[model samples]
Target: MTPRVAVFLDYQNVHLSARTAFLPSGSSGRHGHVDPMRVARRIVRGRRFDGELATVRVYRGRPSPDHQPVAARASDRQADRWSRDSRVVLVRRQLRYPKAWPAEPAQEKGIDVALAVDLVRLACEGAYDVGVLFSRDTDLVPALETVRDLGCHVEVASWKGTSRLRFPDSQLPWCHYLDADDYAACRDYTDYTAA
Candidate 1:
């Protein structure tokens, strides 16, 4: 039987990494956005084992409408677009604005914790044979380790030349290093900000 793969995408992390890795120098901030389903399939295909893509879980941070109406609308639209695919499961957390309001960039709050929780929770529930995390955030390492301890295989995917979680004195957790071709195939140039 083919292994069922569950892909967890940390949106900002992956987007930023992809931009840095593949986009032309001085590309716009939003240029690195990717389609969740496309990315999920690409990574699954890159895996060493023959696997079936089971689900794509996208964890994102949403801007507050009160503070940034335009961005809020764009995020909502993107969410609606992604919802068209049954395999895509989107979890959104509100962005945390700084005390200075628009002066400082709003930070993604709770996204890492949310993704980490689901990574471990889904593993314990036996949701899939393999879990593929797409982020370089070290905060998620513990949860990935927990999933591995549960006997469900855990892997990570990061843009080539970007950081990824590593285990000391062990090779159990594998990583899929996505390259330019993968970025081209998975990128979403849809310009979600457009009305």
Candidate 2:
């Protein structure tokens, strides 16, 4: 039987990483954006086991409307579009704003924990045969380890030239390094910022 693959995406992490790896210097945040379904399909196709894409779980922090109205609207539109796909599940948490407002950036408070929780929980529930995480955030390493311990096959994906989460036990947790061409294929060119 072909393995069922669930893709877990830490949206901000992957977005920033892809921007760093593939976009031109000084490009805006909107430039390197990727369509979640496109990336999930690309990842599934890259696997040697002939996996079927079961779902794409996207974890992201919603922008604060009071602090950044334009960004908040753009984010809402993007979320609506991404979640329209039947296989995509988008989970968004409120972003933490700084006391100084525009002087400092809003941060993602609980996204990693949420993603980690689902990663382990889904593995235990037998939601998919394989879990592919697309984030370079090391905070997720423990969750990946936990899922692997539960007998769920797990893998990590990162843009070329970027770091990926590593397992303590050497040789475990294979990684798929997507290069510029792969990034190009998954790019979402929609300028969400445009009115």
Candidate 3:
């Protein structure tokens, strides 16, 4: 039997990792999107899944609940027909402010927590036999462990040339590194608007 698969993407993580690894070298046609669909499809290509894709969750941080998010901001305009067909669920959270109050702390927070919660929640629900997570954050370790205990396989995907994963890799088992070609193969030229 094919294992049902669910894919989770940490938008900023892949954005930074891919940008740092591919953008600086000018390899992506300098035009691309770490398209959530493409990335997930590539990761599950050969894998068997008897059920409908469990879900494709994309987590992103917004400056304000009212602020327009980056492209994944496609969360808005959901009334359109395309959104219904695409079905990529967006999980938006507020960017955090450091308690110490850094002059400019526009960095995102709570995204890992959101992703982890959904990951373990879905696993416990038996939504998927495998959970594919795209992030290098060690903060997700505990959640991944929980999902594994629930009998869901976990796979971590990140850019190959970036930092060596500092998380519980030994337990996760499958690690997919998106290389230059993999990045190029997944680019959505239409989504490219800037360098």
Which structure among the candidates has the greatest lDDT? Answer: 2
Sort the predicted structures by TM-score, highest score first: 2, 1, 3
Candidate 1 local Cα displacement, residue 100, angstroms: 0.9
In model 1, where do residues sit more than 4 Å from their true spots?
none
Estimate, for each residue in 35-103, the C-alpha lDDT of model 3 and write its tens digit.
Answer: 677778777773444434556788977554343244324434321222354647788777665655446
Over 4 Å off in model 2, which ranges? none
lDDT, candidates in the order shown: 0.90, 0.92, 0.69
Q: What lDDT score goes with residue 55 in model 1?
A: 95
Candidates arranged by lDDT, highest first: 2, 1, 3
lDDT of 3 at 27: 53
Each candidate structure's TM-score, on Cα atoms with residue i matched to residue i, is: 0.96, 0.96, 0.76
Query: Clash number for every model?
Result: 0, 0, 0
Candidate 1 lDDT over residue span 55-109, tens digit each: 9999999999999899999999999999899999999999999999778899999
lDDT of each residue in 97-181, candidate 2, tens digit only: 9888668878999999999999999999999999999998888999999998899999999998999888975755888889999
Root-mean-square deviation (CA) per prediction:
1.2, 1.0, 4.6
The superposed Cα distance between candidate 3 and the true structure at residue 150, in angstroms, equals 1.4
| TM-score between model 1 and native | 0.96
Number of clashes found in candidate 3: 0
